[model samples]
Target: MEVKKNPNIAVSRNSSLYFAIGLNVMLLITWLSLEYKTFDKPDVLLENLTLIEEFEEDIPITDLNMPPPPPPPPVLSAPETITIVEDAKEIEETVIESSETSQDEKIEERIVEVSDVDVEDIDEEVSVPFSVVEEVPVFPGCDGNSNDELKACFSKKINDHIIKNFRYPQAALELGIYGKVFVLFTIDKDGNVANIKSRGPDKMLEKEAERIIGLLPQMKPGYQRGRPVSVPYSIPINFQIQN
Candidate 1:
């Protein structure tokens, strides 16, 4: 046997519809509450209200005492008009000689003697290495028979000069700086030592080496091909601490 109930009396028959309607009503109430706004009403007194008129101040018209304009500039006299006159003297036209040779022109065939040409000797500055110079620079008090002997003497003199002038820099000695300085100097054609340069481990050592080399006396200029020439010489100076 099947039991049947009436739809109006069933509790869960329209539960979804009832829930949907309740949810819509709640959403409408929330929207209305959120959209509602209140403003404060300020109290206004009709007696305190007044209309203001814009007032314009009248400034007095006092005339400013300005200095009178400077006197008119002096009138300048007009320059005399120049009158053009025709020159009566006849002008001589300058004749220009043409340097371009024509085909019919003959070239002169004069004999040029070697003796007729004057030769000027220009003393040009030439530098030569000390090793290959025909004649090495002669140091003072060095007398030798040949170039080899002169070179040996020169070396000996340089060594002696260095030994005589060698003074260890106090700063370098205190700093424990010691090294060999390569000194390059040029013996100019004037027999003077010039362009002294040095390279070492430290500036103090190099400076000391340069100072010693600067004391070298002027030497006889080197010779190359029967002409005096500048000689470039390089030597290493050892700066050793005795300690």
Candidate 2:
């Protein structure tokens, strides 16, 4: 005989459905517990506000003792008799001379000679750029037959001068500052250097560069249109720190 009992008496038959229902109930309880919140009610005491009544006091008006306005000024008396006098003095008529000249008036012709007039010679200081000047400024001890040779010699001399006079600022060296400073100077018509300026990474370097350029000896002024003029020149000086 087969071992077949009643289906209602099978424990495992309804076990899966009971387990699913229990799981759903447990999930609903857990969701409710997580979403539920309770807030604490603060205790507040109510007090009655009492208003105090203010009384207004009356002020007595005092009259100021001002003197009455001064009496009107006395009227001036006029004479009853009027006298008529005749003035017999004659006034000379003023004559105004006309500034305009007529056609018949002869204008004096004066001859002006160029030699008789004073001619003042004014030396105007003119500035010219180095690159476009007809004759570049000549450095001392730099003699060349051609302009190109002169320029080369000038540049060489400038480099030599920078090397000779260049002294790195002790503060800059101590601060580990190194850069290239651009120096600009003007050679005036008197063949003297003026307006020496420099721009560098630091003021110390710029000051040192300016000092070096200022030490340059007098150079021959540049010429333009057969006239001496101030020439502006710019050069870069490198301040390097060697290891």
C-alpha lDDT of all candidate models, in order: 0.93, 0.91
> Which sections of candidate 1 miss by over 4 Å?
1-121
Write the residue-wise lDDT of candidate 2 on 1-243 in tens digits.
888799888999999999999999999999999999999999898899898999999898999999999999999999799866558866678999999999999989999776766889999989988878889999999998877887899899999999988888888899999999999999999799999988989999999999988989998888999999999999999999999
Error of 2 at 15 (Å): 10
For residues 34-82, write the lDDT of model 1, one tens digit per residue: 9999999999766866889999999999999999999999999999999
Predicted candidate 2: what Cα RMSD to the true structure?
Answer: 11.7
Q: Whole-model lDDT for model 1 versus the true structure?
A: 0.93
- The alpha-carbon deviation from the true structure for residue 18 of candidate 1, after best TM-score superposition, in angstroms, is 53
Report the Cα lDDT for residue 184, model 2: 96
Enumerate residue pairs that collide in model 1: none
TM for every model, in the order presented, reads: 0.51, 0.59
Whose TM-score is greatest here? 2
